[model samples]
Target: MTRRICISGASSGIGARIAVDLAREGHHLTLLARRQNLLDEVAEQARAAGATSVTPLAVDLTVPEQVRPVLEQAGRFDVVVAAAGANAALAADAQTHLKGMAWAAWHWEANFRANVLSAVTLLEGLRELDALAEGASIVLLSSIAAYRGSGSGSYGGSKAALHPYAYDLAAALGPQGIRVNVVAPGYIAETNFFQGQMSEQRHETLVGQTLIGRAGMPDDVSETVRWLTSAGARHVTGQIIQVNGGASLGH
Candidate 1:
């Protein structure tokens, strides 16, 4: 059934693809991002794809005050996808390991704020709608890196924390008819996520690790997200569904 959905990071990448896909399926949407121009462009694409109604709210989710008013105005939604994220590369040219510690710390702190705090804040806001709606589903965008701590340090740790949060949320809200789950994705192409820092060799290594033998697309991740929020996945909750093309299988 068509329902109202709110998606953060909807201006691009997997989130944008999800918005367009769901709109084609006739869902009304609220697309949130920090870039107004980009959000408007995405909304237009969703409209062209047959969205029932597409609203764009551009706000920096890192700031609570900015996030509050936009969420309050958006009102109730059947599904909420928290997908906003940022990435910082650890300086690999350090003369000594200790020299890079400060840089890593800064990057880790920023990643935690963006990935963990943002999702938690949004979940808190959704509590306001709990009494008004029969139920709601939340899909948190995590990373395959969450399964095991990686070189990204804080970025991986932030995502790892989301697993427990999702599990606890599902258990706590199950009686209230709410479901929470996580989508841990592997390598998705055509996003500004890596900022083109990945080398051709690095890309090949990532693809080689995946059983699919190639990098994934935005649609690959979005399709799983769409299904997870649907009644078809009603029985599934508190699980971390990996969309990693068979990479990092054991974890």
Candidate 2:
């Protein structure tokens, strides 16, 4: 069956991959991101990939006010993928430990908004837009940092927030057949993340730590989302599926 799907952060990386994968499944997609050019690129690719229809809305999801316009047009979707954020102010306010661990208070708040609320407001705002289909599935993008601690201020903590929220949402909405789950990925490449933060040697070291012996790709995370939202996972909800290559095991 053709399903309607909405994906935030669809301009690049894991989100874009997820949109394309679903598009290949003959789904309709509403792709959201802050960059209109990139979002349009993904939308076109999605159409070419077999999506019956693809809509791109360039919106900065961190600002709650900006979401209203996009939501108005998103309509209802069988699946909603929130993958719109990365650790804010990298290296502790974009500086480094050489600059000290000093970070402004607003920086911590921004981390919360970017990582946590980016997912929360969308799932909750669906009601206002009438944009949540019955038995709809929502996948919130978190990180392995939430579990293994990547040494951060609020990046790990904020991502951790999404895990419990998924559980609460599932319990609250399960009666209505709605499902909510989370994906916590570790060391995923092909994203703007780690740009300037991770060195080639460090990347190699991290990959070595994973039992898989390779860095994770965007497609790896996207494929997990595809399964979670598919009918095969109909009985799965409120779970955190980690795509960490076993890096967190025996920790």
Best by the lDDT measure: 2
For 1-251, candidate 2 gives per-residue lDDT tens digits of 99989999899989999999899999889998888999999999999999999999988887788888779877888999999987776624554333343554555677898888888778878867777888999999999888867575588888998888999989987887989999989899878876577888999988998997999999999999999999999999999998989888732
lDDT tens digits, residue span 62-126, model 1: 78877778888887888999988755443233223334677677677777887898887777766
| Candidate 1 residue runs with Cα over 4 Å from true position | 90-99, 129-132
> TM-scores of the models, in the given order?
0.92, 0.93
The most accurate candidate by TM-score is 2
For model 2, the local distance difference test gives 0.86
Instruction: Give the runs in model 2 whose Cα sits over 4 Å from its true position.
Output: 91-104
Clashing pairs in 2: none
C-alpha lDDT (0 to 100) for residue 90 of candidate 2: 69
Look at candidate 2 and tell me the lDDT of residue 172: 86
Worst 10 residues of 1 by lDDT: 90-99
